[model samples]
Target: MPITRWIRGAKLSFARLPIRGGAPSEPAYIYRDPWKGDAEQGARIVSGRFLFERQEYSFPSGRWDQGTWPEPAQEWLHSFCWLRDLRALGSDEARLTARALVSHWLSYPPTDLLVKNASVTGARLAAWIANHEFALASADRRIQQKFMERLLQEGRTIAAFLPLPAQGWKGLKALKGLLAVALAIPEQTGFMSRFLRYLPAEIERLILADGMVAERSPEAQFQAARELTEMSIMFRTAHSSVPPILETSLDKVCPVLRAMRHGDGALAVFNGSRELYSSVIDEVLAQGARQKLLAPSMSQGLFTRLALGKALLIMDNGPPAAEGFDKRAHAGTLSFEFSYQRHRLFVNCGSAEVGAWNKALRASPAHTVLVADGLSSSDFNAEGRVVRRPAHVMCEHQTDGTAHWLETSHDGYYPPLGLKWTRNLYLGGEGEDLRGQEIVEGERATPFALRFHIHPDVTVIRDDEDIILKVGGMVWRFRQKGGQINLENDIYVARGRVEKTQQIVVESIQYKISSEDNKLQESDEASSKDSLSENKEKKKFSQTVTWLLERIPE
Candidate 1:
């Protein structure tokens, strides 16, 4: 390690050395838990059975040892620290189990890095602080004293090693832990004031001017909003005024959150966000200040949204997220998701529950866009990082007071094949008609495939020249003019399970480019005139796929 990093590490180690001033006073739980508590999971844990991530284990001897637990189980143990499940059971037996679990955890702190992760530690602190009442319902004063001692120790450790709040989602979470510590032990005068000094500025720096989170993820935005909401409530309960900047951040974010939701209230599965439980989203939104829904398009978010009658469309017109925030970013630039009222009609095959399924879901083919030469537009590795992203992504929106549309293009395949994918979308005022065209241009013959995934609940049937979509007591038709369409088997990963699904694929379309086309491409003004005059001849060489989606009465 470098000398500076080594010195920093040494300082961090010393800083976590359990600052004890004899058991800090515990404040009452002020923030309400937004997530649903699982009583069944609590019952299982109390009975010496543990289940997590769809897997189960039993420990009837009722003992858990540090260093022996599997890496996967550490996260599960953190969830147990929340005490939501135990609180839900509301029984003396469950209360005893909770106390014993906390005692065991304090006795043997895990050395694993996962246990010390900023996000995990923040969650542990919040859970422990919020559930103090349930955990300390014991008659033994010694047990209560030990819990407070350990809680204080954990708080100090977290504050000492907390990452800078500019570190994206993890940083936000670390701040959340520090805030919980301050709120839970207001008598810690120095610590509470120190937390207030940095909290407001950190919140402002991470929240973008347009209200989107710095990571450009809907999921992270939701988590940030929820944290701010809790903090606001805590401040109010403690008779302290909520920070104006914090309140402003929450107000600005709620509309963006509302704009990102589908008609069914589920967030768009864009960037790296998955389709988490919709109810949790509802709870978060309920806490924010009410605001108008987002308009048709957001420049800061770099996405176009069109709400026409019952149809809602959200298209990614932005580039891949920048470096530090791109870990969970997907390679599906220019991809989109569509819905009719409460039912999703078109979507990208989203991220799955397991890491093993990441490569397939993150590939360009899984999105509702054209993949050229079978290469992903944005290159991603197995770990979901953007190894290489397109250098440029351009988007333009135009409307004629009735028809709304946006045109977008990306240069992801420019280096390898000198090809670009351009898509134009048009939606009718009534949203009864949706139209699009894909144009592929380059110097060589490039093979491209276009995919359109349907929601698992919807069924598709092929007619003579089009595909029929049946869902939500309505019918719609999918027709193509320049590409062959087929029904292919697919998988939908959401709601904690992977289910068999289907996708409509347009394939085997090749476009050939020549030296003349390349030279003409260099002069934009001259090429525009020439291409219009030679439109028919250009079609012979260029690949153009035009399609239409129209509502059909049942």
Candidate 2:
């Protein structure tokens, strides 16, 4: 390890040592958690067990061991985040159970990598401090002192070891904890200065100027926006002006977040993002400093938003993020999500929370995009970084009285397969007709598949070569020309759970081109022509898929 890292780690280790002298007193400030917790969940925690999807897992004798806890509840247990749920109950029983949990953990803190995680520790600090007003108001002064000591220790650990253990937007979580510690103990001038010194730079680095998160996930953007909002509260507690960078970062993030939402008001699932709670999303946005200046444009943030009448479309229009930031990046270049009014008519299979599904959901087929040779546009290596990504992604948008049009292409497949994929989308004046063309062009015809995942609520009915979709009283017809069509079972991970869903897939029809046509040159403009050639051969029927969706009257 580098000398700097070694020194930092040494300092962190010392910070974790039990104090030999008098314990610290309660922190000066009472940090608010900002987001509400579920009282029902809090009741479950107080019951000494967790209820998940109607299943119960009683806490084991060894509650502090990572392996002892149910896999689904490990992070929540370790970070003590459920304290918020307990506090939400705001009853004597809830308080006693919470105190017991904290008291037990203080005597036997988690002794595993999960508890050692930077983000986990950051969250632990934030949670422990946020609810200190109630969770630590015990008559037992020893418990109160221990709580303050733990907060200071965790905050010091974050300040010393950040950017080393913290990656992508996870760093924002750590920064929030550090700032919380800073505000809680403004008497510690050095600790406060440390946060102020590093905050602006970290904010600028993790969040792009256009407001997209460095991780390139709209879901991560929500996390950043929410954490910053909470930290804005922390800054205010300092009795000082809120940092300008914090407000500006919110300005940049909130708008992209708004544009990334569908008609249901939930975030678009892109780059390993799930549809976070729309209510929490609304609350966070409301807390943000209103943009005094014009907010950043969605296009500048590598997203294109189309809105007219009741139709809303959000498309990912950029290449994967840079190295360190691309760990959770998905092969979703040119993919999109579409909704009409409050119903999601077309959607991407969102990122899963755990297991192999997390990695599988990051592949191109998970998104509403064309996958060449059944492979992702971007490729992830073992470490989760996007090892190969689109080198060039070009996007153009045009809006006229007749339609809102978008054309986009990416070269992510070029490195492995020597191909490029272009997508064209048009939503009509009345927002009823949505037409799209998916084309794969390269040195020669390439076999590809276009997968369109539907929202679980949308009922899909097969009609030979055509498909009909129904959402509540709204109905739409889906038709395709060229290639074979099939329906496949799938899953949509959203709102913190998975639901059974189906997808419409169009597979290319392979055919050997004449020698003269085998080497047809590839150009974005050529693939995006206003009209396809009348001649089947000239149109490259084997490499194109055209589909349309028009609202059908009830």
Candidate 3:
């Protein structure tokens, strides 16, 4: 049942093979004019203009016909605007267009289908191949034979698409799928063995000892996980055993997948990806659950049904895994996604719609921790370049059965003045309820601004002794008494900006300090200058401040 149901009696059709014969010729069905201003128009545009246009296609690396970039491939593989709008015209037109699109896709052969933008090509190709394989089940033998022939050819190409010396972990994922397909084909075992030899080296580089993917985007991790899972399935279905290298790959995939789920069935939209592949994860988790493969309490979430469970800790710790591919990795460093009891408690403010990184929706304030005046730790313009580094200064995480703690620091505002900033969170308790604390430390007693970005739909209020957040008919409250902070709710903040506030409370040993160090630094530096007038002008410059939050136990 994990497979999608197919429509019956849908005979697969194709135009006669183009030949140098003396026979009457007709316009191929793929070239038929589409209805103007109708859904079919889009298909016509794609097929006749985009897909078939000679000028738009280029054989990159002598293998695949690709657009100048990834846009075209993304359009062909995922766009539904054409099919959905065309379906409104009538089932016949919709079906015809759909069939044509499918046929067009199958006809191209894998060598000419993948785009040159290697960053997402592997994942995209894997998805296309997986879906196409399903579609082929209903295809006629002729179509199947043709498809299989192309697959075999592509399988050989994939076998030869060895990892590049400079591509780093990027090629590992694509190669993994390429190897899977190659191994599944009966005659390609020789190529498969050679490909398998390189996997352990790649695994050592891409996967951390703790099972996190090195680049740290939850979306990337999910994509990698899906590919790994699919490869595993492909080999298993063929009654073939996984290569030894896969053991390390699976070790990374399993735990990270568990950590990336939110309390809801959906995943935390991190990095450039937004669409939730819940069904895919569900299927994988189901397999794990059946085999009793999941660690107890490690991946507890509503989406963790006996099958197809969700991830528990989603972290966009850094940019895309592959160095040059992800243009949308955010400036927020060491940012993370967490869900407990199905409630999402922490998040980065998602990226805005305007700008170059617009397609990278994960960079917004709604999905990160860099708040007011605290610029991202890394430069956005330097993305995918050799100079890129995490925007965060430092980050660390530790977990023990019932307790977990995470800490992060950054100097996003340090260049203007000399200062550093740090933030920490600690969560502990047993069973139904949990207690937690946050502390912000810095080099200067600057007023730090922390803005906790929450879903606009949620209600937030400060009670006499506690901070309360309510969402979807559920409530959680954090009480501050005797310098202690206690809470039980899905408290999630995409961004928290804190600055100098007049409010201060003292209890036990915890102290609250908020000051504008940026202004103070400017003032001091100005005082040291001989030009008082110039110093005054400089002092007028705004100052950057840091905030500190300490939790006290009752």
RMSD of each: 5.0, 5.6, 12.6
lDDT of 3 at 8: 12
The list of candidate 3 runs beyond 4 A from truth reads 1-99, 106-149, 165-173, 180-185, 188-190, 273-279, 288-328, 334-340, 350-364, 372-374, 382-392, 395-407, 428-448, 461-468, 472-554
Of candidates 3 and 2, the better by TM-score: 2
Instruction: Identify the runs in model 1 with alpha carbons over 4 angstroms from their true place.
Output: 1-7, 18-21, 25-34, 47-53, 56-73, 79-82, 162-167, 290-296, 381-383, 513-541
lDDT winner: 2
lDDT (CA) per prediction: 0.73, 0.77, 0.43
**Top TM-score prediction, candidate number:** 2
Taking the tens digit of each residue's C-alpha lDDT, what string does model 2 give over 344-427? 977888775456877888889888988888888888898778888888999999988667888888888888877877898999
lDDT of candidate 1 over 69-179, digit per residue (tens)? 444465657545538888888789988888787777666665656545666676777777667667765437666666666666666666665435345555655666667
Worst 10 residues of 2 by lDDT: 528-537
* Candidate 1 lDDT score at position 70: 48
Better of 2 and 3 by lDDT: 2
- Span of ten consecutive residues with least summed lDDT in model 1: 59-68
User: For every model shown, what is its TM-score relative to the native structure?
Assistant: 0.88, 0.89, 0.59
lDDT of 3: 0.43
